[model samples]
Target: MSTGLAELHEKARAALDPVHYDYYAGGVGDEVVLAENEAAFRRLALLPRVLRGTPTRDLAVDLPGGRLDLPVLIAPTAFHRLAHPEGEVATARAAAAARTVLVSGMASTVAIADVVTAARSVDRDASVWFQLYLQPDEDVTACLVERAERAGCTALVVTADSPVFGRHRRDAEHGFHDLPSGLAAENMRDLPGGPPGGVRDIVMSPSVSWEHLDRLREATALPLWLKGVLHPRDAELAVGHGVAGIVVSNHGG
Candidate 1:
């Protein structure tokens, strides 16, 4: 039986450690965005339709390259190992079972290849996508994208909003941002750290400009979809750049 999202969330909260639960549920500082998220939903009214008896309910979505079993697709969330032992590998398997898309985050605990392999093992035709956090150096970003292509990622979902990490007070109270020892973002294993003994930053490029997407296009053949776009003007700019698609998001609201 399928549990409601709210129920699942409460169960997860009850199961995890306090610090980890904060990491899972907390958003950026003050959480005004977080509180208002559900508030926006409460204002919406859905009218019930009269019974036009039909058992078949199609939820598929057609796109440029292929079709999704459902319009829903998983977003790129980092560090799945903190919740499950299989990490993104388990997520890929679940996506395969549901015949949909799983956009594995660049900062996932498991290697990108392992996640892809796990999905294909579960279902040979699973469509696995990869998420990218653009690096400071263009060459580095190129290498990462190429590696993802080689790993059999069907598409690339590039994160656009998180040039810098958000400050979450709930996690901060738990010392989640203190830069503890041995806490590495797995995909960033060999990449440059800010300083030898200093805090290990996310290594994303804050100065990544509009033209960078064109350069990214020139780097790989995989379809690119930019995520975390909220502004209308930026959406128009993304269309100009010839993106495959745009995912409207507020990062974590």
Candidate 2:
């Protein structure tokens, strides 16, 4: 019998085309960092102690704004359509059923509003976080934050690991520059004027800075979080910026 995660992985592998699978699954250069990420988790040994009249296990965790029934949260990843036809909607439903959190990525094919609807369908009070790509324009970033707020997102996750796109040999080999025609980056589409180039070009917002954090705070009342922070100093800086939380990640390096 296969486990739920195993079944999900197999289904995703089968549903997505080979090139798309590699693009979503592959990493930069030699992929040593990717290997290390999984290896590091496996190296840690879980030390479970004998129960001392503990009736049940409690997985709940209290976050800055609310309580999470399960400490586990779905990390943001681009282009959920590659995983299943329902895209982020399906993932959000599953997360809600598990009584966990879902962090929707900026590159998600499903609109933020749709994801929010799905989450609400499962649990009216479900926790959903929106992850931003920091579009090439400051105004675009601001608009995304506002839209997420309208969608009832509880947190804002700014992914700052990618200053410039990394060299992904798999994507380069397959010429995978943009999301497939039917799919789109909804956050980018919500901006006032269209991005500098047509949708295919990866827009890099050169304006990302500490000052941008202030702009983000001004944009919405939702708690802010900075993902992709690996350094202790950067984590400190995020706190100084009045962010509520920090995710210690390197973006699979």
Candidate 3:
């Protein structure tokens, strides 16, 4: 097993196909945000409360969906199958074993039900949240939400950024346009406008607005958390809109 992220990344780089590795490693534009995220972590300093006479402390914290043993959560990342055959199923089980949340991506190679099942098999109270980009088509969005709900997801993480797909130079140079044959975004199967077993491509729209979010809020009883809110004004809007939580992210640059 890898001892640290650098070692893990080196192992992954050695094991994965070059094109697939680049697709997973690279980020949008010049990748400034990705560098900054790394820098931020490096700058993190945990100051110990010296001389405190506490015998023990609990790290568990309760969020809208479930209680987490640690504050850290596994954020949504697409196409886990590109890295391993077990894909998100393996990830879900690991997250459950860690006693934290796994925000499963909408673009996961494993279906949401299977992902949740894998997690629950490890820890019965494991929480799996669904992360999605709201489609321009309301029916499609609703259908996706219903799928998450049916799959036993505890929360919905709405990724509000990426009105358009980012320009990943590495992917473009490597010609990584689609998944390898046999692997697909499993949760996208049988969406609104498609035939039986037909998967609808996820569409990003510049026209998506707060009104779309309002409609979504009315549609589901699950806790709704907004991701990709970097601006303070947008964060304020999210709070006013009854969001259970806000994840201020720059999509890892």
Index of the highest-lDDT prediction: 3
By TM-score, highest first, what's the ranking?
3, 2, 1
What tens digits encode model 2's per-residue C-alpha lDDT throughout 1-253? 7677659778878877999889878989888898898788668776787966888988799786456898778999888886678989999999888888899988888889899899889998888999987766666677777888899898888888888888998888999887777777655663557655334333656567878777787777888888889889998999899999999988985
Instruction: Give a tens-digit lDDT track for model 1, residues 31-89.
Output: 99988876886787767677869888787887653468998778888888777777798
TM-score of each: 0.88, 0.90, 0.97
| lDDT by residue for model 3 (1-253), tens | 6699899889999999999999988988888887889899889988877877889888899999989999999999999999999999999999999999999999999999999999999999999999989999899999999999999999999999889999998999988899889998999999889989987798889999999999999999999999999899999999999999999888878
What lDDT does each candidate get? 0.79, 0.82, 0.94
Cα misplacement distance, residue 24 of candidate 1 (Å): 1.5
Give lDDT for model 1. 0.79
Worst 10 residues of 1 by lDDT: 192-201
Q: Against the true structure, candidate 3 has what lDDT?
A: 0.94
Clashing pairs in 1: none
Candidate 3, RMSD to the unseen true structure: 1.1
Question: CA shift at 182, candidate 3, in angstroms?
Answer: 0.3
